[model samples]
Target: MGIEQKAGNMGVVTLKLEEVINWSRTNAMWPMLFGLACCAIEMMSAQASNFDMSRFGMELMRPSPRQSDLMIVAGRVSRKMGPVLRWLYDQMPEPKWVIAMGDCASCGGVFNNYAIVQGVDEVVPVDVYVAGCPPRPEALIHGIVTLYEKVKEEKMKDWA
Candidate 1:
C-alpha cells in the first residue's frame, strides 16, 4: 500500500521530524575563536553574562575553524593580517556564515590608514554586517538571529 494508505497521516510525522532537525541545526551556531581588535572584546562580552549569548545557543565558541560554522570578524583587518584572515576563513567547513562584527570589520572604522584593508568584505563574502565602533552585545545577537533567518529562508536544493 502507499504511504497515505498505510498510515492515517504520514505528512504530519515527516514535518515534525524535519522541524526538530532544523530547530537543532539553527540554534547551534559554533563561532570560531578569532578576535583581531577592540571589537573582539565586545564579542566576548556578548558570550558572557548580562548579554548572555548562550540564550541563543552560540555559547560554545570553537577554537578551530574546522569545527566552527560561523566566523565572527570582530576587528580591523590590516594588510599584514588580511592573508591570514583569508586563510582561516577558507578553512571553515561548508554551510559556514561570516559576521562582520564592527565598523572596523565592516568598513575599516576610523582606521583609514593604507595599512588597513578598508573592509573585510574585500577578503571574504560577509553574510551579515553588524555596525558600530564596537557593536553592542545586542547588535551581535541581532546579527546572529538574522543569519538564522537567512538559513531558514534558503532552499534546501540550493545547498546541493
Candidate 2:
C-alpha cells in the first residue's frame, strides 16, 4: 500500500493538493483591466514587449472584474470614486488580491487634499504597495514576484 508499489515504472509524480493549487494560482494570475492616473503608464510598460508580463503567465489584463483574480490600483483614488472602486472590488470573485501601485495609489502622493482619498486602502484592502511617484516597471515586477510568494505560502485553512 505504498506509492512505489502502486506505480512500479509508470512515472507517477505525487504532491500535496494544496501545493498544486497554490502553484496554479501563482502562475496564472489575471489582473483586472483598470487604472486611474499616471502610474497606469508604468503598469502598461510592464505589459509591453520589453518587460513582457506574459513570461509570468499573465498574457493580458481582463476587462471584466468577474474574470480577474488580481487588481493593480495604479494611481490616485478620488473621494468620489471610492464607492466605485469598492463596487468593482466587491464584484470580483472571492480569493482576489489587490496591489496599490505607485505613491499616488498607496498614499495619495502629492495630491493630499479632500478630493483625494489619501490612499486606495481606504476604498479597498491592498495586499502590496509599490512605492514611487510612479513606480518603474521593474519595481512593479518585483512587487508582483513578492505577491506571488505571498500567494504560494497560503494554507487551505486561510482560504476557508
Candidate 3:
C-alpha cells in the first residue's frame, strides 16, 4: 500500500511483508562475485574507493553464492561455463536478483563464435542489463539503483 496519514500521534502504518522485505532487500543487497572476462575490471572498480559500492549497501562482494542474494555476471560467458553459471544461480537462496553487467554479459559482445554463449540470460535469467562494451563504474551504480527501484515494486505473488 502507499503511504498513509496517521489519525493520531500514536504512530502506526500498515504495510505488507513483501513491501518490508523489498525495502530491506534493496538496502542490503549482497552481490556474488562472478566475473569472467575483461569487463571484470570495470566491475572491480565499482567496489574500489572511488565508486564505493558500500554506499549502496554492497561493500563486500561474496565469493560464495550461498551467502549472497544478487549476482553480477560481469563478462561474456562461454558455452563451456554455462553449467557452472546455472549451478551457481541455483545455489543462491530465493528472492535473488541477477545483473548482466556489460554488452558481453548481456549478449555475446564482440565474440560471436561457437565458444561464446551469446548471452548470460541463455544460461540464467537476467534482471538488469547494463549496456556497454564494459560499462563504467558509474553505470554499474546506475544499474544497482535501477534494480533497487525494481525491488521496491515487487510483490509476493511475483515470486515463484
Top candidate when judged by TM-score against the true structure: 2
lDDT of 1 at 100: 94
Better of 1 and 3 by TM-score: 3
TM-scores of the models, in the order given: 0.87, 0.92, 0.89
Q: Give a tens-digit lDDT track for model 3, residues 38-106.
A: 778998898998999999999978999999999999998888888999999999998799999998889
Best by lDDT: 2
**Clashing residue pairs for model 2:** none
* Model 1 poorest ten-residue lDDT run: 12-21
lDDT by candidate, in order shown = 0.89, 0.91, 0.90
**TM value for model 1:** 0.87
User: What would the per-residue lDDT of candidate 2 be over residues 22-139, giving only the tens digit for each residue?
Assistant: 9999899999989888989988999998999888878879999999999999888898888999999999998899999999888888998889989899889999999988999999
- Candidate 1 regions exceeding 4 Å error are 1-12, 16-22
Name the runs in model 2 displaced over 4 angstroms: 1-10
With a 3 Å backbone cut-off (N, CA, C), the pairs that clash in candidate 1 are none
**Poorly placed runs, candidate 3 (over 4 Å):** 1-14
Residue-level lDDT of model 1, residues 1-160, one tens digit each, is: 6878876666654455445655777799899999989999999999888899988888899999999999999999999999999999999998789999999889888999999989899999999999998999999999999988877776655666
lDDT at position 117, candidate 1: 89
RMSD of each: 5.8, 4.7, 4.9
